[model samples]
Target: MPTLTLENDVRQFLGSITRRERRFAAAGTLITLLVLVPVVAVADPGLVPGTPAQSATEQAVDAARGDSCRDTLPADTPDYVVCRWLTPPQDAAAVAAFWGADGGANLEQAQPLPAQYVRCNRKTDLSTSTTCKGGTTFCRQLPSGWYQCTDETNGKVTYERYVNGKKQVQSTPPPSPSTTTSSTTWPTSSPTPSSPDTASTPLPTPTPPDETLPPDGNPPDAGTPTTDPTTPSASVPTVTAEPTASTTPTTPEPGNGAADGDFIATAKKARLRIWLESDLADDYLAGDTAFTAALQQLVTDAKRTDVTGVKFADNLAYTGFSTEQQVIRFLNRATQALRAALPGKRLAIGVVVPELGCGDSQPCITGLRKRAPLVTKQHVNRYLRAGDVDRVEIAGGLFGRTYRQYQVTDPKTGKPTSITPALATRAQWMSVKALEWDTLAQIGVREYGLAHTGDTSPWTMAQATAQIEARIGTAIGLGASTITLWGHKATADGQTYRLLNAGLADNPTWNGLTGQGLRGRLAVVIDPTSTERGAADIVHYAKGVSEIFILI
Candidate 1:
């Protein structure tokens, strides 16, 4: 052997090996074909093997012509035009994946091998080959045995099924065509399709009947049979409703103030007072016309109703008088007028007498004492006349005194022990009690009365009431059976009574006096100008008073 060059030696070796390998391969192929041919011939005649015998050129032509093995599928399948078999490896994997390692043996035992493995007999074109018992072919080419079925008409692969090279059996299906035809013809206007229409032609409109009757005439009744046919009976019955009566009372006419029986009973039981004063000066009196009118009306109303008694203060002429004579004259005239006007009713005169010591003096007790006699004599005579005055009240003293002597105090040795002298010894209350008592006695006033000083600066209603009660107690001690309380009224602290009767009924002191023959025996003289004055008078009188009277 000579030394071989690389290319030459390689060529020679390859040529020899090619010849040997070709002979071996041919032998193996012949053996395989023989084995397969017998199996195919003896196996189900419907089963065909190998790819359909078609030229590469012919396959190209058929594909371009849209000639597909898909024609073998039923027309109902969607996109049946694109159905085709899967490749060998994919089919084998599918079978192995589904049935495990023994899947190949089971597939072979099955009636036919898949169409993808069957070779076509080229002499028979699709026309004859397509009608094969177990497989379908087009133009001498076998179709793929596995087709991926899907809903897409665009031929998208969704899922696959291995269709062994076999044809389906034919059976008599239900009347599906007729059913589908009927269902598809249903109304398209609605969401769900409807069945086709089966109705016949509609009838024509009827003509109206002829009527020759009056405008208000009734129509013929359906139940009644026609005889003369001149008149028709009523179709509906008529109903009449009955009227109803109201139970509410009718309102009275406008002019009627109230129903006759609805009036409130007048308060026949009266225990209050009405005080009238004309002491307000001419100008002042003119301005108080309404007050005068109210006073007159109150008196008239009180007289109209039942009352205990009435007392009028007749001292108006004394108002605005600077001199003692002027005051005396005014008091006399007022007393006369009051007596004439209220003849039966008790009338009292209020006197304002000035203390002389108050004029340019220090500790004015001496000066007050000097002027006290003259002042007392004038007012006592003027207001204490018989038939002219019922009672005399000493109104003013200590007109401008701040000294406590005007107030009552206990006497020292050699001093006057009487309350009047003791009270007067004080420049402040000079001649207060003395003038009150002396005036009542000198004028022959049987019913003695006294009012607290009108100067309200130093005296309060409480103090005044206390003073009045003390004086009344003193008079009773002096054998005076009937005494009147003048000035200062009880105020509503909600503890006192509004009426004299109520007060007498409630007070313990007055209750005790009731057994002493003094029940409703003491008279009360109230100054109507004061609010607490009236109430205080009521409380005092109700504690055993014959009458409650207001002195104005």
Candidate 2:
């Protein structure tokens, strides 16, 4: 018998395929089609008569699933998470509702499929799956008819959307930030100044500390969120307080009799310097109250001893102008303020990390401080020196804006290789985490993480856990003395604070107290008011504040 080549079979299938979708009776409460994927691995994809010339029906039928359908994530999956529709969904709502019902099992909720558009001229009707369109095809798409073909957009400032599984190419978006730089000028005109009023509201009681915190450092299941699972995204989230910029700092109200009282009570009085990035819902002042209150009241048998170093976060973000002088001024002012807050001796915790999301080519002082000079290793040293802030912190997404797609990256730099970006490319989400460390090291700043990033990172529990471990490894390699994990929105969600247990667990591999460590320096803190019964932080925000974060 003559040899039947793979190309010949693919050609024969494509040539005679009727493009009729098989119909089957619905058997389960949740519905989905049984999709058949074509074999696209043959070296010669040109076996068909023409590539892009295939009919829309053929294009839809020709779609290939480059990625496999997954429910449980692989162990190595890194920073981002990919949620797939197992099949080309017939009713997007049905799929959404089905997942929504099971929401908070992991993701915040089954989000209404979002509108992610691609600008490709070639077809992307079945974008959710890999298509036979080859490399020229727009590479990425969501089941919600969202797609991206930046290369083939033909220099037209238009974005493409797929509708009803049909290709509808061409719509205009404001020029991308990289093309025509968005204004970096300070916002005096659009100052919608408003302070959160919840600062004084006694924070919701946290889950009984014993039940939520595991002894070995695995985080709590990523099941909690600020919003009830059944609630719509629009309703106010289940929050006791969100500190607004104008709210005055108050003493930390007790949630429990100090989850770890004796150890903390005997500790010396910690004098710390705090630099307030007042714009970011004001999470830190509450942290300040929690820190002091813990110090004073949590002592064993009222044996409250004085402490030496206090936790003060120096997060300089949302400075809309790119200038050394501008950032320096903020540093000096913050230092002076903290110096006054604790008069004995100030322990400056200089945050040398991306507290805000960034886009490359943008100036550092530009609002959001995406990618620019001031935030770079070179200028960061000068700024740190100006503040005389010697302790370094490496964090992102703590206070300012929720980062966009271009702001986060998979940990291709570390081990176990367990991440894939769902919306953005690996390259697009650049992590300057190492750079943040380099800057701190250059200026002789105490380097590691403390109270930053979780609010800003667009990752799942595994990804966040992996990221913490990865950073600890990096910090250990750099001779870091301490590494801490603080989930800023801990009150709204429990996933980030779960890192506390993970941070405390010992890892012998890299001599790290945490995974990213060559040095064993790990610290975990949960905000006094934060609760484990809260909602998924990233997922809730991705749906609720849909405009700000481009859910990675």
Per-residue lDDT tens digits for candidate 1, residues 26-70, read: 334533443343333222111011212322101111222322222
Return the lDDT, model 1, position 69: 24
Put down candidate 2 lDDT per residue, 1-552, tens digits, no spaces: 235687788778676753211101111122232322222221221111122222211111111322221211222222232334333323344443443232111111222222421222333323232331322222244333334445442433334443443344565443554556423223343332232212232222222221121111112222212111123432221111223333222323433453234223222112111111112112322356543443343222122224333433333332232355645665565456545654554244434333222322132124322333244433554565566554555442132212231232222222321111111111111233223444443222121122222333223333333233333323332234444444333432223433222333212211222232212233333332443332222222121111110000
Q: What lDDT would each prediction earn against the true structure?
A: 0.30, 0.30
* Model 2 lDDT-worst window of ten: 543-552
Clashes of 1: 28
Off by over 4 Å in 1: 1-310, 314-319, 328-343, 352-377, 383-387, 394-403, 406-412, 415-470, 478-482, 486-521, 525-543
Model 1 local distance difference test score? 0.30
Worst 10 residues of 1 by lDDT: 213-222
Candidate 2, residue 360: the lDDT equals 28
lDDT of 1 at 524: 46
